[model samples]
Target chain A: MTAAVEIAGITKRFGEVVAVDNIDLQIDDGEFFAMLGPSGCGKTTTLRMIAGLEFPTEGSLKIFGNEVGTLPPNKRPVNTVFQNYALFPHMSVRDNVSFGLRMQGTTKSEANRRAGELIELVQLTGLESRKPGQLSGGQQQRVALARALVNKPKVLLLDEPLGALDLKLRQEMQNELKSLQRELGVSFVFVTHDQEEALTMSDRIAVMDKGKLLQVGTAEELYERPLNRFVADFIGQTNLLDATVADDDMIVLGNGTKIKAPNPHSPGTKVAMSLRPEAIEIGRRGDVPADHVATSLNGVVSAMNYLGHSLVYQVKIDWIDLEVRTDPVASEDRLGPGDDVSIWWDRTADWVVPDE
Target chain B: MSGVITPRGASRTLLSINSLLVFLFFYAPIILLIIFSFSDNRNVGVWGGFTLDWYGEFADSQPTRKALWNSIQIAVASTIVSVVLGTLGALALERFTFRGKQVFDALLYLPIIIPDVTMAVMMLLFFAELAGVLGLSKGFATITLSHIAFSISFVSVVVRARIAGMDERLEEAAMDLYASRWQAFRYVTLPLIMPGILGGGLLALTLSLDDVVITQFVAGPGWTTLPVFVFGLIRKGVTPLINAVSVVMLLASMALVALSLFVQRVRTTDSA
Candidate 1:
């Protein structure tokens, strides 16, 4: 299928400040793509440019092969659900959902009928006449989704649509939004600051920071093989161990531990190795099987936290804290702070990320 | 509740006393005037038997009636002009940034900050100079224009406050839903700020109706507003007739104020 949205060499400058640096991306049709970044990372700006709410100072933006950079928002073939669910406060739920159709010159009866179907799809069937103010936050969010989807635009842009909801409601809405996009089979560009949300819902995720696109790939690809230090630290918790390249496939850590990585630079080239906490195995000395252990380090447990299903232990070794997460098991002796333990992990789990 | 009640009782009692004093200071003179308006005596401050004679006399006064008509005409014209101009001015100031914006903002508040006497003098001199150059004379038109000039600032202040309180995302949402800029403003921004526009209009109407000094400086032959006429009557003497007229004007002003407050309340409730 042809690309649903194509951005080429887009750079949005406000006076002397660059809000979005040179960015070129292609979003496939029917793909659930996410732009993940912290605040002021230009994720929302890029989304706005795609929706035609903003025009790039330097580039071409196309939707389904049609150049739409200079088009106004009203002329774009896309709809946005704003961060605050910006539903028209003066209009009823039905009117708000029907607004796009009415603006497109659809007759009132047809618009209302279409809106009614979307309302039911969002599970807000009886709230057709209620004003936005009378509804709860979650209901309002669903109303916003229905309103944007009711237009049946080629692309749907959502800017942190679940940021306002509580944790439980956010999870529920996240699933609903994912299923809705699946059912519609339309391109969805979801902008969020949440790594978990992006990982859970996106077919592909783009990590951005400070007006620059850092990395873009599938969730597993980006998480397991973050190309730079920012992405490796941003996606999840990881303890970075500074190391110098020892050979073509090995590096020496500051603590003198030798590890193997996929791509090795020249000898003495500084690198950072990223190790996930869950990948590390922790046990008393002589407990771990020799066949499963590739490398081992001894350290004292500095801190231990019980998380019901799992126990997180921070092991202090040679002035570096290595985190180990494991499922809780029945034992008379539990690992507590100040307990000596051995931590080991598979050599394949050591991933090399760019320094700085 | 009991734990929280120890130190607040004295403050609450003091607040009530302060409110009582404020009410007395504000309403005592107006209450006295209303009471005397119904007295049969010719002079005020001496109560005679209750009678509606002064009100009857006020109704029969032809000069007072003509002055009332002139005030209404000026108020209506000036209110409409000021509301339209002020709403546009507020939209420009609050929604857009342009060159000399700070200077324009400072100038917008000039009419509001200048004293009434100074403003009246300045307007009179400016109008007189223009009238001389154009071979014109000051009259109803000059008075209406001056009223509008001063009233525009008041209207813009109110409307700008309303705009500031409004959510800009509503208009953006409208535009995203395929509304043109004009359509978005007409359907969303205009309705949201209508209460402020009405409040400003009522304020302008009341200001024009109550203007005495500006009208005095600008009025030509046979062009006296109610306030100017009432000032003249006060200079001649204080009478029950004056009291009756003042009471009626006060009631009308009060009604307009009440309506303005009611509009603001409705707008707040709608938004909430």
Candidate 2:
């Protein structure tokens, strides 16, 4: 099957500044894809290009195998839910939802009936006559959603739709949006800066930075194996230690400890090793598991933080510091600051990433 | 308590007296004009018994009635022309950018910033030149054209303010929902800026009605608006009829201004 959207060599420039650099991306049909990045990373711009709100300076954009690079938004088979909801303030909830249908020459009664069903679908019954000004923020969001979804486009582009909501309301809307996409079986190109939101909601995420597509993968793949130093540090918490490749399948840490791991780079090449805090087991010096321990090191516990369900200890090995997270209930030996501890991890838990 | 003389109390009394003087300063002449308009005496200032004779004379005079009709015609025609041109100018300035846009923007404000006498001279010269070439004569058409020339600036200023405060994404959303460019503007942009359009039209009407200097410059024979005719009447003498006409104009202007304020208030409440 053809992809919902196929963007090839897309580049958007505003005068001398490049908003979205040359990048290629594909969103599968019915896939919940997220464009994740920091602010001004061009994720929103890429989404706009697909929605035909902004034409790419140089590229070909196809939706279901049709070239629509320079086509106006009205001619495209896609819709967008803007960040600010952008509901027509003078229009009632029903009228706002039915505006697209009316523009398509639907009869007034027929449009009203369809809009009423959509309003009910968004759980906004009994608000047919109320203007957007009279609705709360969440209600307005639902109206915006219904307005775009009423068109029944092949793909829906959402630009940080939940960024304005409070934390609890945002979480609620995230779950709702995920389920909505699932039930409708439409491709959703969600643009957001929140890593957790992208990881939790998107089936596949494209991480962008500085107008560049850094990585695109499933959540587990991105978490387990980040391609570079930036992706490793951005996706989640990790202790990135500067190391030199000692040989093939081995690397040496700063403190001269050699560890057996898969290394694609030649010897003497500098790299960064990503080790998750939860992957490291901390205990007394002789408590290493014989089968699981690929390497072990002795360190002094500099600080300890109680995180209710888990305990995080800052372990200092020579001049390098590593954070080790431990389950409070599972471990009987409680470690405190100034205690000597040994930390070990399995070989698969550590991966080498490029120093960029 | 009555005997106590606090500094705050003294200042409060002074402030109240100051406010009373200010109110009297503004409304005293208007109040006197209304009272004298009803006087039975021929002299405007004389304290004669109340009568509606001047109002009856104002209504009966054929010249006054003709001038009033002329004023209404000019005001209505000028307002319609100015609202269309001015709204288009405002949309262009606010929504697009091109070469020489700064120059165009600055020139839009020239009519508003220039003195009335200068604008009158400018229009007079313009029509004089046009007449020499195109055989255009100064009459109802010339007067209406001049009124529109000045009133366009005011309408555009008001409309531009409304456009500036609007959220442009609403138009984008309309187009994203399958509305063509013209349809988006007709449905989304026009309804949103309607209050400003109405306000601008009423303001143009008031300006055209109140104009005397420019109309006197461009008006030909028998094309005298009410304000110009009133100014001509003042040169001969101030009569109770003139006072009645002035009061009538004042009431009409106040009503238009009140309607403009009402429309603006509705816009604010709708957005809120």
Candidate 3:
């Protein structure tokens, strides 16, 4: 199937500053694609260019295999739910939703009937009479979603639509938005600064940094196989260890430990290895496996935090602090800040790459 | 203010005092004019007596009625011309990023900064130059044009502030909904700018209604506006009739203020 939206080598620049570097992405039809990054990472700008709110300084955009770069936003079959929900504060929810249809020259009755269906879809049935200010943040978000969806856009662009909601409401809206996207069977190009939001809703996540596409993959894939240090550090938590490349697939650690990986590094080249905290296990010396499948490192438990079901131990290795998560129920011996401990992990779990 | 209390209590007190001072400053002259308007005394002093005779006389006065009619025409014409130009000028000043903006800002604010006498004289000089070139004379048209030129600058100044704070994303959202530039302006920008449009119109109307210095310079043998007529009346010494007329002007000013406040309150609430 053709992608609903295809951004090819898009580059945006403000004189000397490159806001979005040469980047290419293809979003499948009816798929939830998230462009996740920190602020100023060009996620919102990318979405804007796609929505025709902005024109890319270079390259082209295609909707269903047709170039839409020069097209005005109104001509494009896409809608956007802007941050703060940008609902027409002067108009009630129904009118706000009907505005797009009205602009498209829909008859009054037709527009209102379509808006009524959308209102119910967003679970804001009775709120059609309330102005944007009279509704709660969640309700306003629903109104914005309903308003955008009322036009039956081929793709809906959301620029951090849930950023204004409280934590609990934001989480609820996240699931609600995902389900709504699925129900509508329209591709959604969501821009968000929150990784968890991207991970929760996206079929494929594009992690961006400094206007560059760091990596694009499923949540688990991006987290498990981040291409570089930026992606690894950004997608989730990882402690980078200094290592010397042993071969195309192996690297020797600082404390004389060795690990294997699929990454290509020249022998004796300086490389960085990422080890996830949960992958590392805490145990007594005799419990260690006498095989090359795992690498063990000795450290002292500097601090132990009891996190309901699990305990997080801040373990001090030779020269670095390593976080280790262990089951609190099984760990009968409570370790204090200064307690010595051994940390072990499968050698395959260590992700080795060029130092960057 | 104690450490226990923030500026909240003190600010509220300050706001109340400011409101009281403003109310007194605005209404005290109107109150005096009203009291003197109804007085039957030929010489209004300490309210010698109350009667409707002055009102009857003022109403029957031909020159007074004509002056009133002339003021209305000039004010209405100037307001229409000024507001249209003022709104466009304000939007241009606020929206587009351009060269000479600092210069434009200073130019827009120049009419307000200069003394009324200076503004009146400059306008007279410009009009004299125009008449010399085009073989014309200062008249009702000249007076109306002068009012529009000076008061439009005031209207633009009042509106530009509101326009500056307006959310530009509303226009973007409008376009995203498939609205063309014209549609975006008509639907999104126009409604958002209604308050500022009204503000500019009111400013222009009020300024034109009360203009004295500019009108005195611009009006020729053919023109006689209310302020000019009032000046001629005052030269003959203040009368119960002048006070009577003044009372009517005072009431009209009050009504204009009430209308403006009503627009402002409604616009502010709508925006909120």
Name the top TM-score candidate.
2
Show model 1 residue runs off by greater than 4 Å. Answer: A255-258, A264-269, A282-311, A327-344, B1-25, B46-53, B134-136, B261-272
Instruction: Give model 1's TM-score versus the native structure.
Output: 0.91
Q: Provide the lowest-lDDT 10-residue window in model 1 chain A.
A: A286-295
Interface RMSD (one decimal) of model 3: 1.6
TM-score-superior candidate, 1 or 2: 2
Which candidate number would show the highest DockQ if scored against the true structure? Answer: 2
Residue B105 CA displacement from its true place in model 1, Å:
1.3
Q: Across residues B1-272, which tens digit of lDDT does each residue of candidate 2 receive? A: 89986557879989889999999999999999999999888887997899998899989999999999999999999999999999999999999998999999999989999999999999999999888786778889899999999999999999999999999999999999899999999999998888889989998999999999999999999889999999999899888889999999999889888878887788777655
Q: Rank by lDDT, descending?
A: 2, 1, 3
User: How high is the DockQ of candidate 1?
Assistant: 0.52
Note the residue pairs that clash in candidate 2.
none
- Candidate 1 interface RMSD, angstroms, 1 decimal: 1.8
Residue B235 lDDT in candidate 1: 90
Each candidate's B-chain TM-score, in sequence, is: 0.91, 0.92, 0.86
DockQ of each: 0.52, 0.63, 0.59
CAPRI-wise, candidate 2 is medium
Chain A agreement with the truth for model 1, given as TM-score: 0.93
